[model samples]
Target: MSGADLSRLSLNTATVKHADLRTAVDAAASAGYGAVGLWRDRVQEVGAERAARIVAEAGLRVSSLCRGGFLTAADDAGVEAALDDNRRAIDEAATVGTRELVFVVGGLSGSSPGGPPGAATDRDLVATRSRVADRLAELAPFAEARGVRIALEPLHPVFAADRAVISTLAQALDLAAPFAPGAVGVVVDTYHVWWDPELRAGVARAGREGRLACYQVCDWILPLASDALLSRGHVGDGYVDFAAVTTWVADAGYRGDVEVEIFNETVWDAPVAATVATVAERWERHVAPHLAPSPGAGMRLLDAPGERP
Candidate 1:
């Protein structure tokens, strides 16, 4: 961005799901992206430290680790396993030099003793979410000790049945309230929260509470894909009013990484370079405008000495 000095955009590895970690980092850097978000699978492919090294060597920062939570489960063993996994994810985030670990808090508890994601018509969302809060409290100390914070991501409410029970910025903040803002906060992703009627209020509240850990940009498209998870699109390719939501985030005094996390097969199948290029271009056009030292001036969204968004 030396030419126009736009804000540095982060490429969530899932956006380029087809690429290996090394290749993804290379493509991101080559496309002039300054940061990246990593999933555990990709990190495990080359080991966590090495993955961190790969990104650092490429002169890129690891904005935030993709995830570390799924605390909703009907069985005690399954819950403990998720807790153990979260602890491991905390260690990985520390090694990767990112303080924020984005968590997709899980959905309905399964009817079987196995865990969630199975059909469970009798599940109780209230009880599941209550358990989510308890688990967050349990993990807060571990994350705080390692200097890693849990950034709860609010998936669309539709996903509340099978994905994350925390389905709104409002709900995430409530779960995060019991922990320190640094230990537990919320990820404001446009793709998920764009449709919320209380988006403005939620963004404002997140800002006021200093619970805005990350701001993810993506758009929603119709004609649902076979896998609904792949329904995200480039910023301008969908109906998301990025300017409005981004303004809400910026006005809330959030000075962190604005991660570009998408999950669409079309994007994944595209040439990685072009995908990164498209992400960069869209950030400049749709997102960057509402952020920075001054939105009107359109200064680059600076990542200087702040937590990764």
Candidate 2:
């Protein structure tokens, strides 16, 4: 894959979870990836400053930071803490040189920030979603101040009870509509949105609204792992029709980095280099050709003139 064109490819660090930040950055750059989507844990391993240095030295851009939201806290204290932590994440994202801070808004009322990983003490999905919107409003201005956008990521409906209350692109767009497109945006991850009947329309709306912040890819493999969160596979490994989805994204005018963010045990256990190589090959065969030929590049940010990147 040495001579392959990976100009728009991004390797999400979670796809190679076991590697240290330096190793992952080096591997991604060496594999011809133009960017990398970083997980907060990996960024914290060497501290945000040093992590930024590693990525910069490797010549790879930071596509987006993996996560900053879990805003469905049931109490005021929990809510405040979630907000503070997100503010920290925003700072981390800015320091790391990415304008998008991916958000996994909390699940039903009692999931993260209070209970066990997926335990929901209360099932008021409506209230939970309301709280997420309120929190986003509070954080948007702060995020915009530092040249960062809160890229809300809606999980697949299967994870709605415990992982995310925002389970569709339409819902994410609604939540983001109240803020500046640069300050709050939506992420279109294939693993999460591929099954939606409204995906094409939603992608178009995102494009029209200038809210398509990030685009991630992975297949929805069957025989889901005991932990459904790890069920993601490479681009062409399973049920996803990459060409179709990629075409919709291209038509929507999303020219940002297309990140490959797999979470499967098999891919995690394989050699990092081999996994990246496979992603590059699968992307070349299934996704590359579907992109726009030479439209204007880069997603437009908010009206905050100097910060749009």
Candidate 3:
């Protein structure tokens, strides 16, 4: 990637999971990122209202909220509880001043850490996915009322049995079809959707339908971790062809912030300054060039304190 400006880049707080909201926002701003994607835990650290004040004081925008969707509960009571939690999450997103709320729809019924795959034990994949759709229908109006868009994120197929059941951008788009574009949308995350055979067409479909609410980038490194969820790498460190996927998103008319949401333990353990600088450098080199020039494309970017010259 080349020529793209830094005006459109955003730092996802999960990439620096150890930092508090204030520190993360400040680090992102100092690194010249235009926005920051917040996680619910970080926001609740000092309360959403104060968290919004911190981000606003840093002169950065809140790109999106980390999540709000575990709607795969089996019984009526469980379903209603999930809906209530999502409603609270939507309210938090509004308080934090962002329009996009990213949702990682839950896995199978009995899935648990260190347990058998839910698919092997439950075998009710169809029922679980249907629950997600039904829950979205229930939450859509509430999100719309607060000017928030529920951005459904499709995890890689590897996570279907434990983390998220929606495993392709096409599936997410299909799920978002019943609601107004402003109410429901889809997240195009490279780490998750990069391997889909239908990725190109799916991205185009998302753009055409105005469902492309968020675009995230990270590399799928090999030699998977024991947990598998921690396998993300910095841009250019893995095999993802950012130039190709970025071009598709740009061509699809998505001009929103491009977030760097890494899940690697190594990245999270690194110093906040070093991680932020590395994200800027890698994003500029591997993911920025293919992007459509954002407004204020030539805006000045401050060099983070230890950034390599």
Using TM-score as the measure, the top candidate is: 2
Q: How many backbone clashes does candidate 3 have?
A: 1
Deviation of model 1 at 53, angstroms: 0.8
lDDT of 2 by residue, 63-159 (tens): 9999899888889998999999999999999999999999998777665432364544778888889999899989999999999999999899988
Q: Which stretches of candidate 3 lie over 4 Å from their true place?
A: 1-4, 117-121, 293-309
What lDDT, from 0 to 1, does candidate 2 have?
Answer: 0.89
Task: Quote the lDDT for 161 in model 1.
Answer: 79
Encode model 3's per-residue lDDT on 1-309: one tens digit a residue: 233357789999999999999889999888788999999999988999999999999999999999998788888997999999999999999999999999999888668743686554456899899989999999999999999999999999998987788999999988999999899999999999999889988987787777889999999999998779999999999989999899888767688999999998899999999998889999888888788633432121112121111
Candidate 1 — what's its lDDT? 0.83
- Give candidate 1's TM-score: 0.91
Judge candidate 3 at residue 34 and give its lDDT. Answer: 91
- When 1 and 2 are scored with TM-score, the better candidate is 2
Clashing residue pairs found in predicted model 2: none
Question: Per-candidate TM vs. native?
Answer: 0.91, 0.92, 0.91
What pairs collide in candidate 1? 214-309, 257-309
Q: How many angstroms is residue 115 displaced in model 1 relative to the true structure, after the best TM-score fit?
A: 14
Which 10-residue window in model 2 sums to the lowest lDDT? 300-309
